[model samples]
Target: VQILDETGKILVDSGVQKQYVDVTNTQGSWVVTTPLVANQKVQVRVKVSDGSLWSEWSEPGWMKYELPEKRASLVVGEKNSTYVKADGTLWMWGDNEFGQAGLGTTGGKSSMAMKIANLENVIGVAVGSNHTLALTQDGRVWSWGYGYYGQLGDKNRTYSTYPTPEKVPNLDSVVAVTAVGDYSMALKKDGTVWRWGGSSSGVEPQKLNFTGISAMAQGNPRNAGIVLKSDGIVLDFQGKQVPGLDGVVAISQGDGFSVALRKDGTVWTWGGNSYGQLGDGTTTNREKPGMVKGLDEVEAISVGEYHVIAMKKDGSVWVWGNNRDGQLGDGTKTNKLSPVQLAGIDAARIATGKSHSMVLKKDGTAWSWGKNESAQLGNGTTVNQLNPMEVQFSSK
Candidate 1:
């Protein structure tokens, strides 16, 4: 394998470099070191041989380099994973049984990362229980996979799954999208909220007349979607406002509860507590938002099926709720009713699945633990891990 510049000048040759192979076969990655110049156009070609047979050099795969920066993001679903690169290309992996990976096929599953074909200029992405949505730089929205509840926003509530990304009809100039638990929600650039799929009101996106809305959190099945107005007031999907909360900056809705982060560095939660997801030191469900004990200066929050994780401003991570699958990452399977700090690491962002937890470290590396039933851990195996493990991708 060799990397060549636009003039066909070989810059890095791998033929004489140290090669790495997996003896366990479960490992599926190789490390290739090369120095890349900004705004450089490069291509790579590879050939193979096996004692008795030799293969010709493969066609060159071209790529353009951008200024190196850690601006990428990741989202983990119930059985799939989506990653958006700094260059605006989206990539997916994990279970594709329902075509949720958006790889243009509902064919079984793939442990290898597959770039979502034809998806470009993607500025943001969100994944639902079995569907996916992407927001482009031009404000166009695209959707695919399980549309049983009309979450695709195509105006039809048919029980179908799209293998490829299809533009959501009747929506444009959208700034954000949220796909979760059979339902979908979008916020237009006009400060208006639009909803579709699985909401009690039915399938088509109905415009909520409330302006000054800035952020939203979609409930995960049977829970009400909540949004934050510019004044920091919280309102439910039915347009009814929830009192006792103000100055909210961000929000997250879980399986049966909703969480709000305030400007004062406090975390508040409401709704079902069957799994102690509220993290208030009890199993009592609160109809109104209540402060989560022992957490402050929270920078971001991520919620899974019945668990929640908070990243503090100091770069520490804290978790609570369901630990049946070790999603809590406390090195124990015991569920906690109050938040517990996950020691020994600092993170820039956090993403959660139904039963797994992942964090992108400040150093640009990804780590995950818990449910690996569908290889969601991205560690090239189908084994559940109770501790954080680095995810390695195969090199071409």
Candidate 2:
């Protein structure tokens, strides 16, 4: 591999450079070095042996010389990054290749934090492929990520470089909000649910006309959901009761399915089951919620892109579904048709990134596993894994 200047000039030549591989196989450094020899303008070019002849020098990684500048927030496209500090301050990193970081136009990945101004009461933060959402205790939602799909919900197509709260014509009454990947969902005080986004999210779940709705799980496009009433009844958007289940206390988003945890500790699931992600011990797809059969005492649950996880009241973690990307944390790449106990993880809180999961312990510690292609695992670099590892949070 050789680092070259824009005019095809050599910057750094790894003499012979014959031992290198392509970008996909490289977890991180094989293409460009970190600290990047400081303030240098260069990109990556490679040569490889592919079964026969050495492949021609491949196209460059296209990276260029960039001077370091600080920012408060940034948003590019699919790649988004943000963080909440110990002092309640906010920071961002990633593709901001488009200024979606909310820190003005300082796009591109930043190793430092960009301060989102004038915003207070920061409680939680979420990112989409190119947009950002910040949650405040006052029940207000701020967005600055992608706006191209009307996803910003600000009803404007112009991109923003700072956190701005948008009121969905009828959503000023929203009580809580959630954004997954590039879609958004809101829960209302009237036991209703609301949402907006791309077709990928499917058709939006209808607005319910109920009084006791207590919880909601992701729904079709924009934001739809399976509403769990206070009386242990599940209903669709028009107030019609959903058949075949009850006792749901929590609901989570999964690849092509939804997992609901009943108050009694038993688990129920429905929707796309191509990978048997529902944990019913079979690969059959069920349009309505079905019981998980034997999982009891489940205290918490989370859904990965193609996998599901549950935490038992006894500190045990259960994993299921697509294991090809190791999102199951099952110590192997083989997918599971039903829930399997994830050995050795003593956890309290659980969170699922697109293809990875994080386990937060009672000791202020965290463990990560699955895809690390973007360093979402926080193990210090981009490397996918089949098992969990301690995440060293960078405070610097």
Candidate 3:
């Protein structure tokens, strides 16, 4: 097999200058380790031999380079779900009562994902109770939906709802955005924090005094903000360091609790554990961070109103906490005090809504389970799913 640049020059693997590399019949694919320039166009052609005469080169297949930020992503709100395809087109469905689906109407609910014609080049999306925020490749933010609490960040405090996307004023260079409850928060490229919405900040975004923040997560219902610093320390919304928590690489917040993933692959939890969402084997609220029971080598995590979903390095998913609606995807309504492995799928990404859960599988397909009263599962039905079911989109 050989890889050629746009000009037809053969690309050699690193540490060797050979124009092509031979592969065994057993090898189904190969990786081109040579560094590629941004936006570089390339093509590949393959040939096979049966230990005799060599076959002619196959047709060249074109490949287009895309930045890492251009990859697809999924996010869920209280009762709605949104997805941005790799091509930068956005799609959404479920509860549109408040127009959170960004479909320009609030009367009908969509069970299958519908494309949002107004949004393009969306790199990331964040959803709150009834509001949605989209971050574009240019580092600008767009908002819509319930605006009574000013969560829209569009500087229209009097407007109760925005059925269409509106550019959030005064925010630029935003690397990330998170929303929950009645407000929203943004992290800038400069490591600064900006907040708007709710009664605290009004309609315009206010720059918080906090700095050096590497990432941020906000708790649902509680609206508590947690930020991770480059120095590996975690701080709460008050800018106070979380007790006994350090070396944290990622953070997520739920109803009244917080979760942190350490660099060592262990999970930690603190705060309200009324339903054992903390995975500590006891419904005890932790004022300080403590290691979650029976979990390790965790690669990623997502927290819902009263549940937690974790993915291991091997792609296995585990969940614990309030499972009254089967959000845990364990095929039962039983709430687990400790992490329980979710069988049947290998997850590439996971998201949790108020009472539902979603998983983007390694094969690029999406699945969902749990409460579907509002059709948030995107399965074309309103039946509650106790196990994972493939989400059906209206169109590709």
Candidate 4:
């Protein structure tokens, strides 16, 4: 057996062995030890020998060597944290009073991150106040946790809580899922949005009339929904376009405000500014989107209950708004009316709970801070961290 490059250059050669096979031995496999570049095109050729004479080499079989996706993702809820490792395995920790941990038990809390035993191939996850939703690679959505408000979207509203994963029926081709408060939203591959739970939508998933949505964001305390259309326009759930907000590449909603990241790397925010979560250097809320003060070259942004986190193109993280619980990760509990750089850390992705913050570094390590009374930080303690602390995960 030989593995060759596109140009027929041998990359791996498995020498002939003395092993013999009978007619019944139809199933066979080989473990190739050669290290190939990711996404590199290659070919394979195999031949059989009968101890004396060798058969002709078989026709080349074309293949591509793609390394497993190694990007880690983090999502934080009101008092729980969900993590998806590079291997597509899901983990949960912290508050479980309403069974948000999805460990098949309620009224219990886990200080250390535990791997979800029955869920796998999870590409994305979203959490509400007490419920959780997971999106698999095959476009299926699985949910658990509080269902009294129909947040589970399983069409069974009689059950108040689900401690384990249950399929959200009639939901397929879902490319993304997000939940906040008691409502959930899903973005389909066809650019349509489906919502369930909350006061407006009931237990069953209801397809919104709008289409061409590329991404979405939902607020925690306000129950507001914002969507980013493929044409770069940002619109509210009521089909109203946000004034002066266009060319948006991403959008996020917090307690009572919403944020948009433009293609020029500038951030615009509006809505509740009680804690200056809008980052406009003023406590007054605006009816129209305004440019966040002193934020530029921003690559990504996330919103918490009353705080905002923005990662710049240089890998630096900045925070502002409600810091009463030190959710800003600035080593202080003072709220900043303007964006302040979070020192000593480079972030690859960021997420925020109601009163806590999380960062996933490029090196695959995760850190958390702020409110930890429910052990949401996953640092083996329930004490709030004014500074970032490394999260502890179980080996098993």
Scored by CA lDDT, what does every candidate get?
A: 0.81, 0.63, 0.84, 0.88
lDDT of 4 by residue, 1-396 (tens): 899999999998988644446633545566564456679999998887655677899999999988666578899989899899877899999999988898899997889899998887788999888889999876889998888888888766436778999889988889899998888889999999998887523888899988999999988635558899999999888899999988999999887789999999999998989998988788998889999868899999988989999999988999999999999999999999999998888889898898999999878889999999999999999999999999999987
Candidate 2 residues lying further than 4 Å off, grouped into runs, are 1-120, 124-127, 156-173, 199-211, 219-224
- Local lDDT at 374 for model 4: 94
Candidate 1 residue lDDT tens string, 61-94: 9988675353777787777766677788887767
Specify the poorest-scoring 10-residue window by lDDT in model 3.
Answer: 12-21
Candidate 3, residues 130-209, lDDT tens digits: the string is 88899987788998888887788766633677778888987888889998877888999999999887762477888887
Clash count list over all predictions? 0, 24, 0, 0
RMSD of each: 15.3, 22.7, 12.6, 9.2
* Ranking 1 against 3 by TM-score, winner: 3
- Judge candidate 4 against the unseen true structure and give its global Cα lDDT, from 0 to 1: 0.88
Question: Residue 235 of candidate 2: its Cα lDDT?
Answer: 71
lDDT score, candidate 3, position 92: 87
Off by over 4 Å in 4: 1-70, 199-201
> lDDT order of candidates, best first?
4, 3, 1, 2
Give the per-residue lDDT of model 2 (tens digit) for 65-170. 6643421221111244444544446555444554556656644444233556665545556566666766654456667755655556655443333334343443
Q: Model 1: clashing residue pairs?
A: none
| TM-score of predicted structure 2 | 0.67
Leading candidate by lDDT: 4
